[model samples]
Target: MSTDQSQGGGFPAQQQEPPGLTEEMRPQPDHGEKSYVGHGRLEGQVALVTGGDSGIGRAVAIAYAREGADVAFTYLPEEEPDAEETANLVRNAGRTPLPMALDLCDRAACDRAVEQTVEGLGALDILVNNAGYQMARDHSLEELDDERIDRTFKTNLYALLWLSRAAVPHLRKRPGCIINNTSIQAYEPSTTLLDYAATKAAINNFTVNLAAQVGQDGIRVNAVAPGPIWTPLQPATQEPEKIEKFGDDTPLGRAGQPAEVAPAFVFLASPADASYVSGTVLGVTGGKPVF
Candidate 1:
């Protein structure tokens, strides 16, 4: 599926690719440029969202910014342009944006991202552990290489652990919240994405346990498990044939947009709507069975 269809020829066809930047997407995902209306749900708050340069992360950043929060995000080395565009959208929403590039798999880098976000944004009120990667392998566990398994765990699980640990102290001080991005695969495993499913399951467990530990400190921990959304990751991770029919089997006939999953983050981060909500997983998987 070429993501380069022409829109009306005036504004250019926006890219709709998953896991990639809004700029590169054929029909760009909505950033609520003029659509999303905010009423100060998160005013005066500060948020740090990993992978905020694109996809669901970008949607959350824009929503947070619209709600009057300063946002900081981390992206991979090669994703600078998309990262900047996300920042610009935040600024356009009348909020501050701090764009940083770092490899979350590196413990030191994760710590640095936390520290820099706190220093740059003044205070961190919300932390969104949204960065992740996966590879589809048809091999069984025995045939899976140790290296691939290790990498998957490192990126999807360990990175969240390290980043959350680093952010906890700062979060504790402000009674902040943490929102982890999990996957529907955590509940229903896909044969091809064995390692990815395992990591997501770990994330689900981590969110529950961490919420219990942090509840006393007034820190909330939660997760969102999204089945399949249109993002750059689809094309980058799956085969073209799979990409063409993405989300076709879901209860919703078509795939979801990034905008649809982002409001869950906004509600979880905002005290107004989720003061009593923690240790819960919001399933945004297009009416898929979560239980």
Candidate 2:
């Protein structure tokens, strides 16, 4: 609520196992619940946001519903409680919310998610590839094991590919759009986020290339590259010491809330607002450059 840039100036030192929960957060991250007034920007749309259980995905799902879209979203099976809460938020917005528990690393599951959205929601208008994985082992290349690398790549990159491919046919029918969730880490690489950052970079390339390929069909593709926004990912992925100083280095000097980032996704999804906007990476960072 205060743009003073002092809120969450530095987080209280905390940690959580991977895939943290919102209720477990110290100062819970905002998901634009009481805020974010809508103006029918995405009216009549049907959106599928991966990882809609919490964080940026949750915020986007809520915003989309408020903007008049029936929404379907995915989350890890273990995150069902969080997923239910997100679905409730969507329902509060007077839109249908289909919450599915999924393991994105499973390629077949990714395909099934797209299929379920199409079948359940009636039509697909926006696809937000927002689910991702990151862990800060702070390990050297030698210590970063193959298993972790595989999981990171599979979750962040492979799932995007699988889901997008499956959704393309449906997207083509509605001349829909695809919005990928990338990160500033793609440009400013962090050694600890080696695999994650690499996948984000690949996502950027994929977004632009896909836009070009789909433009003639009236389908737009783009990405949102967020900086150190406050999300479950931070507590779960960053070292505890890093968490205390999270987002302090940003020009804004505080971590952004999920509410702060949802507008970007809203803008990119609304054809009225961004019909000509394709092959673009909208940076919602707190003054971090994604270039």
Candidate 3:
């Protein structure tokens, strides 16, 4: 079995896997499989996490489970094994893991995901909007394709709005919370990820506005803006050369692990840790500037 560090990058020539999840992925992502210590921060709550099969989503799911919340997660059908692994980790942490496969880019699918999560887990006390996609390009503004821009916006922004809208009814009943996965690039835009960065900025705005709108209903909404973290999206979307140097140049001098960022979700979900917190964006970008 390959250790976590060995699975970083550089797979064998014979291994060919899909973009989302592959059995041959080296150092398979650490989904809190064997390591994740919990402290019961979220006992008796329910959480729904999009893209919860791997990366930060997986980490959050496991952490939520360990912290005493049953979790419902979404992933593509093609990533069944990885999704199952996440569910299993949640089970090991003593929480039920309801894993569903759905394409969140569709409004109907987003609604269904929220519905199914509520049906399976009883009620949703927390929502983690963590699914996203990005492709790097060094093109000028004039060269950017309209389709790519639209797709990025649809996946990163529109789906979030749709899902949040659908879940608000249930959230209102229980006085729940939402935590969006924004990116550090929202503040420090990358030349290659223009559209992606724009969507993240929009996410920030949406989170703040939603928090204010729902505060009267007792629903807290916040966001987590992570900087450079080692996740599958890096290798799936970037060039191999760029992959090799992932997270090396961050202010922290290294990319953060998903485990390191998952705690923020736990903190925001629990009223004990964040009773007065709402409409705020917690910066977890390895010491990056917020402005």
Candidate 4:
């Protein structure tokens, strides 16, 4: 019930409209623009990261490009500004960047995204299902509306299936991988985020099953379960007061930054690093047990 005090932990009260902009955050998130270094672990590869305009997705795009992989990332319409910035960062790494503006709730959009990545970048080596939607206004199911619940399911779950299904064929050819973004909420549910937590738990199940289904194709499927990360999503979706005390309950007593979660995605996508790693949900939480 209380936030433990950490030297660099805690956020100030802030608020933003839906689909928040990174520039509007009080203490801007660190997406490894300057800190991440490449070692050519993913040379000549192409990656598709959903929700890559900002947050963990942007960090992964930056890291993937630095690692010598061309990246095609997706964003909502309102996120063009952030998407442009992400694309430029990828370019700065001397790798091609394809920034796709999409509404993943549409099945056609999901297929086209994968199609464009292969058509645009030549091949698809990694697919990151990182786009997620959640709202904090509902305290109970009685308070939850159909529109909000449907949007949550469609954005977090349906789009994952649509994108992965379309990408699997391309992934099979290159022996590529899929890295889904799950959350600690999968294990520890919050009353306000019941729908989001539900979808995340389903993602854990899907990751493991999909890995089993495609292991024969030499394709690995895994997920990253991050705890409280300092991303634009926080201020956009959470109550301002709650934002100030975020991540205090973690064993580390601090929230993680987007930069901190990118390496996990890179590790999973790298063939040499994760040749035998599949069906596993890797925890990037601050000592939170994903199990």
Q: Which candidate gets the maximum lDDT versus the true structure?
A: 4
lDDT of 1 by residue, 1-291 (tens): 012222221222232323455555555555455566677999999999999998888888988999999999999978888888898999999999999999887899999999999899899999999998876624477767888778778889999999999999999998999999999999888888989999999999999999999899999999999987777676666665666567776776666777778888988998979999999999998778777
TM-score of each: 0.90, 0.97, 0.91, 0.97
| Candidate 4 regions with alpha-carbon error over 4 angstroms | 1-7
Q: What is candidate 4's TM-score against the reference?
A: 0.97
Residues 1-291 of candidate 4 have per-residue lDDT tens digits of 012223366799898998899999988888887688889999999999999999999999999999999999999999999999999999999999999999999999999999999999999999999999988855888988899989999999999999999999999998899999999999998999999999999999999999999999999999999999989899999998888898888889889889889999999999999999999999999999998
Off by over 4 Å in 3: 1-18
Can you write out model 2's per-residue Cα lDDT over 81-150, one digit (the tens) per residue?
A: 8999999999999999999988999999998899999889899999999999988856678877899989
Which TM-score value belongs to model 2?
Answer: 0.97
Q: Would you give me the overall lDDT of model 4? A: 0.93
Q: Could you tell me the lDDT of residue 136 within candidate 3?
A: 75
lDDT of each: 0.83, 0.90, 0.83, 0.93
TM-score of candidate 1 on Cα atoms, chains taken together: 0.90
Q: 23 in model 3: Cα distance from truth in Å?
A: 4.5
Q: How close is candidate 3 to the true structure, as a TM-score?
A: 0.91
Q: Name the 10 consecutive residues with the lowest summed lDDT in model 3.
A: 1-10
| Model 2 regions lying over 4 Å from their true place | 1-5
Candidate 3, residues 115-145, lDDT tens digits: the string is 9988988998998999997877345677678
